[model samples]
Target: MFLRRIPSTIFGIITRSRLSRTIMSESPAKRLKTSPRKIGTHNGHFHADEALAVYILRLLPEYQDASLLRSRDPAALEECDIIVDVSGVYDGTKHFDHHQRTFAETFSAEYKTKLSSAGLIYKHFAPALISLRLNQPVSHPSVELLYQKVYKEFIEALDANDNGINAYPADVAPAFNTGGITLPSMVGALNPNWNTPVDQAGEDALFLQASKLMGETFARKLDYYISAWLPARDFVVDAINKRFEHDKDGRILVFASSIPWKDHLFTLEKELGITEEGNKPLYVLYSEGSKPGWRIQCVPVSKDSFESRKPLPDVWRGVRDDALSEVSGIPGGVFVHASGFIGGNKTFDGALEMAKKALVM
Candidate 1:
């Protein structure tokens, strides 16, 4: 998060500067009369955080066509409309520098990872940006959800990478060289290599290239969250709320249609008090429009775990159609996976019965 306090004197100064920029940006005529919105960051050896921070700022209406100012000169930076990932001061108004010794901000109290310039910019501007993308009020539930989720999934990683925060514990080592290619690595690759002649204009061009890449990737993730991910929550919540209709034990969830549901299932479980064994959903039944059957899937122990809370009966494993129906004494059976993670039936009732029989058998 950005520093909460802004000294009154400094606030007055920043407010006027920001106000002037806003006024200048309101019309093309005025912007031509004055200077365009100028985004400032230190030149040379750019990192993913600042690239992403600059990109995030450009998403705002005020800075959509903002000019980039790559410089280390304080006088030059002072002339810009806003500063990011540079300048020693972090009043959360004019300056958004995180390199200062006093800087120790996180996304929220719940988070302990120190924020980079990316996180700082996102913390301040993401809600309104999300609102713009979603066409809703800043206070809207979907907008808030998208804001938090996008930060966690996208922005936080850039912050963590820039701040040198390890994703895993020091004691833990990955089985493989996991970081094959990533945003930080990609951004770092864009920098001038050793012995490469550093042309100022060329460097600026490459920096904008990196910034655009970061911005487009971020926007794509946000777009997915808005169009696909957010809608799944409604489906999952509807299923969760209607679980009792699926079974008296409240251990089965039935969806009218298939959805991207695993994440929502886990989150909504904790949120809606699906913690107890008796009420916890163990199976999810959903229809496939392409196939004439309803698939019943065993819920994983957790979102990341491969283990199911209760897999389908072992006898039904790899069995198909009439054979499975005969073995399980449940008609209209489709094949159960060899792993016993999932099965299908010709009808929803048959699927429910299979789940019920699996529960007891």
Candidate 2:
């Protein structure tokens, strides 16, 4: 099993006035009034969602001078010169019984609606862009590259079963197969000597064992995927540098769909040395069970938590402010998540318009 710990100094500041000058010299906007752009990225397959966000940002300049300005509040729209919806899904309406409504029927739909209602422009880019940008065949290896390190370790444990009495041969080991077992049967399999009156007990035991083994195998596969896709992280880092031009005061927020995606970003941060004074990045707020290195504040949404919070705009403002302060002296600061907001009546076309307005704001 391969084991390597990511460094704690990934978020360090690289200060050089010369580098900053070079960056600024390359952009025509050096003399223009560049408003603060708020980018909201959602995690989905192929990084297409993020790619869409980037695409929207690219379109902002064009839209700033286009004809899509009549349907929106020119004032509120100006608050953010650019709002990129990196969330990979779109918003749609569904009719249930006698009433009609625009709500997310899938993951993408939910995200689109949330951003739109919040008055942010949302874009839902086709998933194909991700494949095109990657320009890599989706071989078995690529599919397997999405796993996490812990998942790989779990598979190893099942493969080796080296814990003596509890060991199972790699050949017959349930972990070798991706299929899972049922909970009760797995328990029975581990303790076969005991007799149970239920005829289904034996089958249940087998299923339980299989489930445990399957979980381990899945984790291993995930780790492999992440290791393979590390290059994508470089692409994102470069994009940030090019778009923001080493704006140390700006905050970047990244939203991904799964743990693996978050882990990928975490790994990239380590590689790029984005740290705090050569120390680990500080996680001021986080959900329970989120790992330290992941740099994610996993907040599971529920009715109660949702009701207790301030409006989405206020929440976003707070997050943006905090991130900016944290990386006060650094060239750029980033916040990443798998999913940020729920979807509403917003469409990709609307998001493009929003992006355009953001640039001029």
Give all candidates' CA lDDT scores.
Answer: 0.82, 0.28
lDDT tens per residue, model 2, 55-162:
222233222121111112334333433323321223321101101143333213322112221111221221121222233444433333422232233322321221
* Winning candidate number (TM-score): 1
Local lDDT at 238 for model 2: 49
Q: TM-score each candidate.
A: 0.86, 0.26
Q: Alpha-carbon error at 35 in model 2, in Å?
A: 68
Report the Cα lDDT for residue 209, model 1.
78
Decoy 1 TM-score against native = 0.86
Q: Write the per-residue lDDT of candidate 1 for residues 21-114, one digit (tens) a residue.
A: 6566567776675444788888889888888888777666566557878889999999887899998878777688898998999999988888
| Runs off by more than 4 Å, candidate 1 | 1-35, 320-323
